[model samples]
Target: MTFLGVFAWSPVSSATVTTTLGVDPGAWNVWRNRRLTPAPLSRTWFRRASGSPLVYQVSDVLVWLATKRGEHIDPLTTWRLSLARDFGTETSDPVEIRRLAVLYARAVGPVIGGVRFTTAGFQAYLASLLSSS
Candidate 1:
């Protein structure tokens, strides 16, 4: 079920979700591993191939963000909304999303949950997550 006309039924990388939400990769990892984040479609829709990256339902992510707003989570909620506001709720351009990620990341500083989340760190994480695919 697609909402906001973004990813629809498509698979979204963890890095795309993390960068789009402006959250540190480590926090994202923790959230998913702890079940704080919604389960990805990969969990039941189909078996992911041995080396493919896990994918999430964009609608699930949006709903989770909308309801999880709090002191620590508010900033991420803001970034999620900002993408809709700045580029329309339907916007899903990777280039623009990454551009906005850079802008927002700089303003907030690259540290969250005590992890130093530089662009390099993000790129590295993305590489690692995608490398096996």
Candidate 2:
């Protein structure tokens, strides 16, 4: 005698997953080097102002430089030096110097940080003084 048997079939399913991670050592080195290096003076405004012949140009630039380096500059003394440099002792007018000294003292804010001066006011004052002279 012979016997017959039947079997059922079923389908199978599968899935795949992938992941990646990496870092460049050179990038870390560049970042570290940048952090350790001091910042260079790249101020374009300062460069432009340096070329001008205004009475306070030199003093303004000096005060700006001092402020950038976290220091202070005496505005009165700076103004005096600037005047002397721009106009030698032989040519410097005592009355004009005294007037400018008063203007500087009025415009200067304090002795702590960066000195402040009103450019328009100073320019107008200078123009008037020169026109009168």
Candidate with top TM-score is 1
- The digit string of per-residue lDDT tens for model 2 on 36-105 reads 2212122321222333311222333345446767987643445455556444533245465557654543
Off by over 4 Å in 1: 1-5, 43-51, 70-133
Q: Highest lDDT: which candidate?
A: 1
Give the poorly placed runs of model 2, Cα more than 4 Å off. 1-56, 83-123, 127-133
Could you tell me every candidate's TM-score relative to the true structure? 0.42, 0.26
Computed on alpha carbons, the lDDT of every model, listed in order, comes to 0.50, 0.32
Structure candidate 2, residue pairs in collision: none
lDDT of 1 at 86: 51
Clashes of 2: 0
Q: How accurate is candidate 2 locally (lDDT)?
A: 0.32
